[model samples]
Target chain A: MTDKKEVFGMRFGQTAGGCAAAVLVAAMLAACTSSSTSSQSSSTSAPAGSNGTVIKIGVELPLSGGDAANGIPTNNGVLLAVEEANKAGVPGGFTFADDSLDDAVQGAHDPAQGAQNTKNFISDSAVLAMVGPFNSNVAKAEIPLTNDAELAEISPSNTNPGLTLGDDAKKLRTSHPDIDSYFRVCTTDDKQGAAGAQFARKLGFKKVFIVDDNETYGKGLADVFDAAFRKAGGSVLGHEHLTKNQQDFKALLTKAHSLGPDFIYYGGTTVTGGGLLRKQMADAGMGSIPYVGGDGISDDTFLKQAGSMANNSYYTVAAPEASKLASAKGFIAAYKAKFKSDVGPYSANAYTAAKIEIAAILKALQADGNKLPTRAEVRKNVAATKNFVSPIGNVGFDANGDTTAPILSIYKISGGKAQFVDQINLKT
Target chain B: MDIFLQQLVNGLSLGGIYALIALGYTMVYGIIELINFAHGDIYTLGTFVSLAVLLGLGVSGEVHGFTLVWVVLLTIVTAMLLCGIVGVLIERLAYRRLRNAPRLAPLITAIGVSFILENAMQLWRGPTPIAFPAVIPNPSLQFGGVEIAAKQILVVVLAFVMMAGLQLFIYRTKMGKAMRATAQDRDAAQLMGININTTIALTFLIGSALAGAAGFISGVYYQSTWFFNGFEAGLKAFTAAVLGGIGNVAGAMLGGFVIGLVEAFATQFIPQGAQWTNVVVFSVLVLVLVFRPSGLLGEALPEKV
Candidate 1:
């Protein structure tokens, strides 16, 4: 009996050990296979057999996280621009290649990963210009690193004005000093938030309740909107700050409902409980009141997730509607044919940013007598961008690397789609 | 007073969910002494399964009346059955051999199983929170000043029925006696001809079915479900189990209700309480544990010679 028990124990121990080893091996293999496949796809998509020198444009975005809903479409827009540029050829026989990196850590944008990605791009000599680090917080972590390298970084979706101006900008420049290295296609939140407030006032909403996701982008927008709305003679009923990724908002909504506001404004992205908040607000008998948000909540994911509750909600996007732009016709058609999906909120901005970067690179190459210009020369050319017409509109960078488009469009979610409602062109 | 009453209703409905999930943790821990961390993911899987069933039934758009009732009943039954089978499979494949090994081994395996389920769901249905079909109408009824929704009533009533049914099964059946015998003394029960594996598997089945019910009800009530929902809900339910007494079913239920009420009132009254809700909930757990180590209902086990 003792011998039988000993044999049984030994066999069971070996089986368990073997099972664990098998699991480890399987997990490692899955990781390896996934990485290899992604690299293979990126390489296969590049233009083949070009005799020109290969220059890479690194696109950093949260391709796999909660922000992927925004990042993937933005990346596609960048890719489309790169493909168009390569087919048309740059000024100096330079072939543009897109090297996309995911700065998402465990399904959300991580600043550390963004910094590391920037360092990798800065270290690569072939990289001429960079297109994105989608979120403003990610850009905050990456700007100093790119500035140290004097690499020109253009963002397609970052909207926080503090990234380009204000105390945060001062803090960023105090260490790096090369503040002009960063630029974005989207207009700043100061303008967008004011526009949102203006739109609300036009709709005759006197009392508004404000809620923010408590992130850099959300809080800044909420503060600006609160000030602007009050300045426009609208009364602020209440303001609340919610932590990101919170699923429950019933208590907050209940509190807000008691205030009896004419409208509710959410300063947050769709991923971080915006859709849930809207749905719950509707469920709490607040559906008749108008809901307004910034560009963050202007994605299809929000529309689908919010379902019937999405109706009557207003969102502001920094870029004009793509279909309305005559220059965007071909790009939109090609995008639809290739991706089999509607062009998202920031795709036009991304396409515009990529084109501007390519235009600057071409200008630098031409200025350098058909040789690849230094990173500093590229930065100077991008900063000197003037009257560069693209799909979205005229693109130019001000002294502080802010877009000078002066255009913000308001969209209403009607019939489960973002339909263009109005445009406010600020007199700059 | 009306606001307080409304919050109280919300607290009870939310507590019912935590209690259902905590029962899974308490029962499994009672028998195996292993905190089955994967129990939460099983709950998530239960939600996804029900989502798939609803989608497959072509019950999209607005469903109503007897049809809505049948659809919900079908979803609950299907999710419970599927999750029960999944629970048994996980125990047999991943946990059975580790049962006799060191305690740390099964604990680690439980975590591993959790990752596997979470990732599997993430891969199957992308990482985004999918909208759960709102088949049940959520119109509120006002009584005096208190407001109550139909979904909240369903959640609380269904939870209590399942809990009562589980208690009855554990107390009144021959299998329940065998399970009690095994939990009391595994070797002695085996010597007395009770199949140890069967009893353990039954524990997993019942626990997982309760988790499934919780998941289904939550998906309906919240109108959303995601892969990571299990992680937060699991942590809260585990705290509930510990707060009640890890091995006591009734204690787990009471602990869940207390935690829920605490969260609701804290969010309502405390300034910026939404930001500090988790802190307040866990602090209560710590205070409870510090004062009563055996939990509110748990009897201290006699020290072995």
Candidate 2:
């Protein structure tokens, strides 16, 4: 019995040892595969300094879901910018390459997805630079990921004041003061609001009623505009806050009518503010009141839904009119030829973002003659740039990565089209 | 006063549609003693069906002198018929087997079915709301410098017509009497040679059909709808039905209009977030329920013999 027990114990020990060995081998193989994959991609691709070396850039934009109506066109614009950069050729010897991904998953603008997308971009060894995450919410989610990964992120449309300036500006100036990986081409809501106030004054509106959708973006823009309007010698009739998925603005309109404000300033996107307001005001016999709004209302979808009742409303957008830019005509024509659709609100911004990305990669490659710079080095180089001349004029960032340029305009709804009035230069 | 009058007209019209839909809940609850959670989705289905009919016929937004109106009416009838069939089918598929089970079982089944219908709608029609073509002309009548749309009058009249016709059907018609008899005593009706199951099926069909018309009118009036509109509208109507006395048919209609007017009034004076409007409305509901648990017109059914 003792001999038999000894043999059984030995058998059991051998089996256990074999199982452990197999697990160890499996883990090793996984690590090996991951390393091999990265090394393989890195080695197979041409070196940044080599002739014909394709400089891989990451383009992140909402391509399918709620924001797709705006995002897809912006993506097309990035492609045009990349193609132009490739044609222009890097100062050394490099051409632009793009790896685009759809960030239009449900809650795409949520911070979780932003972090996940940033991680995914960073994991791709070829992608040295990234662009996008249109909404400020997305930017908030992504800033940390990009900061840690050291990959540069240039957002074309994130305008929330707090995203750049941490949660509270008083606590610490910006979200990541020491980190220079993040950049934004679009002017902040502060500038847009001031421009809207100026436009309201120019139109001879002495008293303006302000309404916000009570979201971060809407409330922020409303506060900024209210202050500016007051400074511009405008009387505030009333201020109202509304939530999402709300219909029936008759009561608010009635009160505003009683107040007898000459103009209405709605600081919210088209989904929450556009159709209901237009329809309600028209139904209330105030169709020609000349409402003013920010970039959130610049979408054609707003006009389409609001229909003819949306006529005479005004909106403030971040960039100049793409139609009038003589230099942008070629870019626009190329974009349409490629995408088979009109460029959306953020298209020019995305194009500029892509240019910024290419410029950073080229700078990084020049600094390191043999291999491409790490995401961190590229990010640092991107932040160091003092001036860049792209589609939207010179691209330069202040301490907050906000554009140094002061270009905001008021566009009127004429026959269901956004007709440009005059640019409101705040610097003046 | 003029603005109030105009808003009153809008509120009444909006309430009329709600009342029409509320009747469906009231009638279904009257017979089954279970809230038909899926009723709103059925209404949404009706709207989509009508939209499909209009689109299939290539009807444009241009109203060519009642031609579009006739087409829209046809579409509405078709939608109601389709919804009636669906209501009967759902009864057979989901509710029939659970007839003898606990009441909670059927209620849970109805909620599950509601989710399925909503998700299916999201799949069939993309998340974006399709703009329903405006069949009614934008009419503005200036009385004392206040403008009111004729569409408002049309909707309110349509609701009353549906309610009166339904009331007559229940009280005056043989099938209606059969439904009331089944509600009174199912076993006795079954013993008297009236098929209880058939009467229940008919109740669902009629209720769903009325709801279909309500949904169609809402779409036409608002000129837009999302797949999720049914959920919100459904919740509001459920509240309305409860407010009027769940089992009472006329009470449901009264409750719907009251809720609509209250909502319109709340939006006008309450400067709070429009989202808070629901809180205010539901708060009133709680207060009313505290005061009257059996509801405004509800009478307790006689104890079992």
Candidate 3:
């Protein structure tokens, strides 16, 4: 009788064990999020000279893990600018030194670590300015810290608009809302989405349907595209947000097909069903419709996943062709010589940002009567930087701290590769 | 009306794949009474296996005529055999030792095995989606705003044929009787002439082979797959197995079609239907569990104790 009770208890335990199998899937997903490639804080010492006082320029970037490729080159560009500034010499007998911190926690950028990096950069009294934070989410966390410290911060690649625009941005700098301490050399997503809408109108598309990956970046981009596209005299058929990892889009596409939209716009990255959405469009008879997307989908993965159906799909990248820009020739040569690698996508932008920071520091030093000036003086000069000529077109920041010249490059996929199409410069 | 018909076609095709996968879960559970969490990854492994065979044969784009027929059949067979052997090995290595242990022991080990298979595939094939060639020319016939592809019809037909064959194999063969006897009472079957080890291994072999067929079918239909696809597919198949009655093969098939139809109809009827499809399907699951714990077609067998 006791043996029978034990077997029954085991059967009940077996049923509980079945539920644990599902729990185990969730636990394994968390376990797979591993950390690797440690980040190091390396400082470059300026060569000593007559009456050379070492002034520091601090930087924060995701320098290890998966973001290493994106962060290392941008950091190198900043270092290159400091190296040049020191060799050329600064006013007040100042020799520039670099104090860089890595914000990556695990192969990916962590916002908390970025905020901590901002605090560390602020504590260094000799640190004149800050550059970095490759991702937008990281910037949101770091900006408030820099703003409170009256430290000048600049980003080379963050394209999200909420960082520098609107009353929401004003809330970040409550200490001095009127005086913005943050700036970015890259074009914003607002301009990119508008550019997509303008391009759609230029293509003579009368009606379009929009889809987003239901993520912050994708949804924001699509929202702007939806509004701007409607304002551009084009009819929006419908907008739908896709659940992440949802594979089959046949039913959704069939509904879209019935509406008879001439174009489809997907505001998402390759991993978030952008490529698969395009591929499966063929299954539902909407394969012939021209597909448009933002920089999220402008990846090699998109080209590879879409296969033969890749043709006629267009995507917009909110950056100039920096590598191909004639003005970037000198910077490109210096980058290759220094790093023994090709200038990455945003290397020129990083160079321009660093150069602009150096120029601002010199201006502040000249104003401070050749004396060591406060970070506030540097912040003022950087904010007052009007339309100045640099590598990535005109290098100047507007009141909201966006690039004065916002450019969007368009590319089309054909022959299983993305080919460069055109670049549109938004008149802001 | 045409839309209804179109969605029905889509439901049946997608449901067929689910049924194949559910049969695997149900068969393994019927014999050993373990959920076999690694079964989903076996399907994933089968996909990569077929992909390798096709690519090795210098296949790209679309192959036509007799070459297409042989290439697909050969790849599908290879995936099934390899995945079946893998299932058998997993039993012999990981689950066999834990068989006599507590129920939680083998269940956790199955989860561990599932993680290894997923990571192994990710390591070998890279983490991104690999493009499968469109060897199965998907030309749909359209009538009155309703579209149905030849591939969809083929998937449904092939799934039914495999399910029917599995049904016969489980009922008519000498091995089938041994499996049934062992499932009923392992000690009693051992007292007789039934080899319990062989019966359980056969269950895994047959179940895993069906999952392999499902992998091949989805690979050809979707034309692209990733290492992570197994998790999503496995979760849904697990839900279907529970909904049908975990230990019954026919119940799993019936439950699969129900889930598939529910998914398709939700997408068609609901606003932003794609967003709400998963919610509706899982809601059906929650309702079933609350009202009828034994599932739709499951028998309320009396506890021996």
Candidate 4:
């Protein structure tokens, strides 16, 4: 009787302890997740003007964790544009300020976080125009919210064509399908993919194998590459869509090796197994095969992550080489001086996007008789933007909100740096 | 057949690292019913320490034969020691307080420690994935149609050697006997003159040391690691531990290899296999648990304190 009673007491005590710990852990996990996702308490870098009127450019990007490699530099570019606009001074005695939000959760860009960030930006009254939500998937989530709120969002890096063209884009903005609120400064994946396919053939690669990171951006880019490469008379051995955050691709690479492709095409960023994939490809004895990707892998991070295997790899950026362009010289120097980091692949494109937004906001204010314009009025002005000279070249939007000044730049990795090779004029 | 052979090599190489991590989880659970959620981060911490040490020693871009062997051994040892100390501190500070508390308390505490370690690493190393320079030169070894990597062989051989050495230590060493006694029944072992605290701390020491080695090996193998790498890698190791019978030592080693082989084979043969790798891995886990609730090597038992 005594032994059984003690046993019961011990078990009961253990159960009670377990229950208490469970609640504490549950509460902590909840707190941790919420704090990580909510980067909405962003600081404004804009100075208060003499008129005490501050107009804000809401910035949303994957500004933390692994995506920071691309997103931070992009954010810096946007911030730089706002600083310049503040110095130049708008017509309405309004100071242009930036209110940024991070859509990154844990270490990568997340769509749900992007949606929440969009809501936060929409709730802010001072924000008339927004300058990001970089990834294509994040843009897809954010567009509906911005559209419903009549807030203008201009992405610097989104390349998926479905975000701007066809029935697919119409589905994203159900609130105002006729009045497009989403615009991107970069060219579409179709142009990039076609350019890559033709380039691969020119380099004498007859057989190609394709892989994607299995995200909206990656899959879309790979699909375009597949169709274009096939039409160019290059045999596509196989195309595989890798699971998100799936680290190991040795087996996939091994399988691709047997198919005996001369080239491997990856449609993903450095953060999404892009660098590791090429390194493992070398381990599978296919390291010498030229690897091609869209702008996602064109960043310097890709070169570092791909290591010694980075050589012979080629990628296409859907924007001009901002560093090489004479018009972009001042922006690049300013970006470097401010961020203490070299201009990333999409930094100039983001700068151009921000500049366009500021220009439209000033234009809207001018049309409003030097009064602060409504989100709708500012959005309309942004949509009406045509042949606005900027760092990345003449910026304009078509009816569908795709950049009219579409240009694709090709680059090859040499000495662990991306060397500009050729430019394909993507504008029809 | 060639694909199969190649994947076999890939699986074995990957499995060796998982087994090392799983051993830490299993040993901690065996000694104390606490899950040690931070075990995975301990592995990650190991990798960072190894990287720091390597960089400090000016080792980068593949060291030659003798220098390579010496530096790898030195770096792994330093990582293991640092990780072992951290494991001990974690137990002494966190798990020790909750040992007699409800089982859920320590389990939750383990998770808290996991976050703390991950966040701390993030703060130290920033958010982006840092590339570890290749320490081993890539060379292909031909076996008919199958080609194997020298690095793969090193990972497997080193893992097995450590596991074997651990086995000897457990069965032969007197401290090992004390640890076994403590694991069997804490109260009974206390009455039998076994120092329960020391034994438990020692268990954490060995387990975390092995995990640290795993971290070093994985970092060297993968060539890139982020602060969050440990979380996913930890889950996989935890799965291996559970698959092999959580408290069983030899079981973790076997389970690790099995999971690796399954993932590799599924990726090679399954249509859209890369997408289905986790589904297949978890499916096998569910199926195995349904048939054998105690896992493959686990003896049937009710809840224990």
**Candidate achieving the largest lDDT:** 4
Q: lDDT tens string, model 4, B122-159?
A: 99887667888678776779999888888889888876
DockQ for each model:
0.33, 0.28, 0.41, 0.46
lDDT of 2 by residue, B155-195 (tens): 88887788789889988999988987888888898899999
Q: In terms of TM-score, how similar is model 2 to the real structure?
A: 0.81
Error of 2 at A140 (Å): 4.6
Evaluation by TM-score, superior candidate among 1 and 4: 1
Error (Å) of candidate 2 at residue B131 is: 2.1
TM-score of 1: 0.77
The order of the candidates by TM-score, greatest first, is 3, 2, 1, 4
Best by TM-score: 3
Better of 1 and 2 by lDDT: 1
Q: Place model 1 in a CAPRI quality band.
A: acceptable
Clashes of each: 1, 3, 1, 3
Please, what are the lDDT tens digits per residue for candidate 2 over residues A259-337? 7889889887666655667667766667778788876666545665677777888877666655556667776777667
Real contacts recovered, all predictions = 0.32, 0.34, 0.37, 0.58
Tell me how large the interface RMSD of candidate 1 is. Answer: 1.7
Decoy 4 TM-score against native:
0.76
Quick one: ranking by lDDT, best first?
A: 4, 3, 1, 2
Which residues of candidate 2, in runs, are more than 4 Å off?
A: A1-129, A132-141, A160-162, A168-177, A189-191, A326-351, A354-378, A426-428, B62-69, B271-276, B299-305
Point out the higher-scoring one by TM-score: 2 or 4: 2
Candidate 3 per-residue lDDT over residues B1-305, each given as its tens digit: 87788788878777877887888888888777898999999998888998899889988777888998999899999999999999999999999998899999999999999999999999999987888877787788887778888888887788678768877887798888788788888899999988888888888888898888888888888888888888878888888889988877777888888888888888777877777888998999999989989888873122223
